[model samples]
Target: MSRDVVPTYVGTSFHVCSDRAADISRSGSRTSSLISSPSSVRTVTRRQSTSANTLLTLDPRRSRSPSRTESGDLIVRQPAKRVPLVRRTQHEAGPATPQSSAMSDAAKIQLVCTLGPASLDPDVIRKLDARGVDLFRLNLSHTGLEELAATVEFFRRHSEAPLSLDTEGAQVRCGSVVPDLVLAQGAEVELTADEVQGSADRLSLRPRSTFQALRPRSRVGIDFHGVLLRVIETGPASARAVVDRGGRIGSNKAVTIDPSPILPALTDKDVAAIAIGRRMGIDHYALSFATSGRAVRRIRELIPPGAHLISKIESRAGVQNMDGIIEASDAVLLDRGDLSREVPLEEVPYYQKAIARRANRLRKPLYVATNLLESMVLNSRPTVAEVNDVANTLLDGAHGLVLAAETAIGVDPVGAVDMVKRAIEAFERIPVGLDFTAPGAETDGALLTLR
Candidate 1:
């Protein structure tokens, strides 16, 4: 039998279903009887009012049923079973585009833009929104409570994109160092626990616990390993180090130490920020440096009930505990920046693909963040390599791509957003299969042949 297709609205979009046999069996030939008899048939079709994602079923008996008009032609009206369409924000992205309609929930690429001085303006936010920004991230590490509240209020007034408050999990960073101190090779410097205006010879670091963990001959990296320093001596609240690799160091840059110290998952500032965020009705929270399932559950408890918890995997512990963390959280985020501190730079890509595949298997959303368009931080266009990387990330099972400095502090914030949108579209255009299996895939010989 030729299948009868019924076109109906699942949400705002129309979905076609083919299940005429079930409808016929349920209606007991009443439809056939009416269709066979034209005299009793009437063209009575009323479209259910759909206002702003309202879910309403189309009933053929009352409105949309096949009938015969005066022209002696059969008119077929589609009737669909009731299916509730739950509304989701862009952050919880679903396959909405026609090209992506058949894609599963994991295939929808969410565009997450971090709000910063460059893109925090109302106009820029609106532009990013128009380009389809799914979520706006507020880095708690860089924001105080008052400023965080104000920023949250400001975005609420401007855009409807969901806000994500990213906690500053256990990490060390350089305190106020003015004039961009350029440390030369073999230059001796002092890293103090005391807060001070830093200079070439002396600097301060935060989370004194990490300073206390330092030992003689320990290797330290500053500003994403821009400059390398080795500890020459340790003190009660400080450490003296000699520069091994020279580079310009700036204020608020990340600092990494060998034998990373054990710190609390949530900082005092993070708790304060969460309290402020809860008051503001923010429902999305990203826990930075999420090391284990226990930590994810802990943060999940602190947030509002039913709020989306995104665990950021950036440390060695995080990678080791990936399965448990992915199982515990609503979603997972692969932070390649801080992750490199523990993981070698060359191995980052391998980790990214592995994390993406794991997240896909566990049916959780995974967002890749950091340096997506690094060159665009100063330049108007992204590097070719960066574009390729974005596309490959999607192919590797990343449900979303996050623009940090690219949209937050880049020279052309809107342009960066546009590029991300373009990258997603380009990825969708490719017909590459992400889940491919070789014949007898379990065997090493088959796997090698496929490779």
Candidate 2:
């Protein structure tokens, strides 16, 4: 009536030892109790294996029964049949291995999308969430105080991603225009501080001091240089400029002046917007045109506790004092659009590389904004150069990418986000081959040796 029994369950313990004969001889009568009768089941313990095929295996087929030793102890071998391998998902596989961790870190590169008329609806926000936006930016320059609360509430109602209230720092902008103003090259136009709807003959510029500060022969750029002008005459509240480059200009377009005027860090509207944001429990603020560490510290005082301060480097002064600004703020954003106005357009790439390197060295997050996918705003696809620029930005150690017009007013906001997501994933798949370090970095005791 004795039958061989083999324990199929993994990690099971047994009363019998491997050296059954010697153990029974030494124990004498104790062996009788341990073995009892052969009719009693004799369990064989299973040692755990790392192999996927053998781990957690069970087979009921008795293809090969256990064999009994001279001492009546059973010896176990392979189970009756091998269990099919069970695949595990990332979560079921337990903690991520080091190799997997390295791959996942690249996907963590943040994507910030500005919420505007095109993408501000709940359905659009949800679609953007699905497309993988880490943050939704509320550009105060475009959002009036009356609409601030409703906009913040709209985002909270639909998306779970964090909200970033972007302040309208010190930059001067044009007021409302009845229709698009078309500036013809070589035409004389009057830049006035009057808050009237703009026309081709006269454009309204905000912050009268900036208008008065314009001197004869000073160059000006509007709408990111869509139109360029040179001041011909200066007045108390207005200046006459001759259009050097002509383009159609719209409402609320940025006006950049060379020998940039000295203005306060936070404008009156910015302060009022901050109050609205605070009351709405907003904890993230992006300071535009952050000129110095002092400007960052000043706004840091107005934000809520535990709020993140992202200082934007967009002006000559901001770039000159980048080290201090990056050190003072929680994160840094490089506005290449405005920056190009201050520095030669050709030098923006160099600035991007330098800023990215410095931010990486300091262990601070750097987000690059402007023109990442400008063409995507109108077309369904991005240009090849745009895609390459995004890939290079990631290679430069940018922690995030911000899409302003692309997602804010683009025809295909979701498509734009998908493009950025693909770029990030593609970058993650690249095999890390070289270990780059600063020129003066100490080579001794380095974790990774440059090949």
Clashes per model (N, Cα, C within 3 A): 0, 0
Residue 368 miss distance in model 2 (angstroms): 0.6
Q: Which portions of model 2 show Cα errors greater than 4 Å?
A: 1-107, 434-451
TM-score of 2: 0.72
Clashes of 2: 0
* Model 1: per-residue Cα lDDT over 1-451, one tens digit each: 0012122222222111112222332444322211222333344334543431222343444333223433544433222221111224724533123243443332346888898899889899888888877788999877766688888889888898789999988788888887957899999999998889889889988877787789999988988747999999999899899999998888777788887778778988899899988887788899998888889888877888878888999987787778888889878899999888776576676567557756655667788999999999999998999998887676556777899988878999999988988888765543222111444433532121110
Candidate models: Cα lDDT each: 0.71, 0.71
Give the TM-score of each candidate: 0.73, 0.72
Instruction: Give the lDDT of residue 5 in candidate 1.
Output: 16
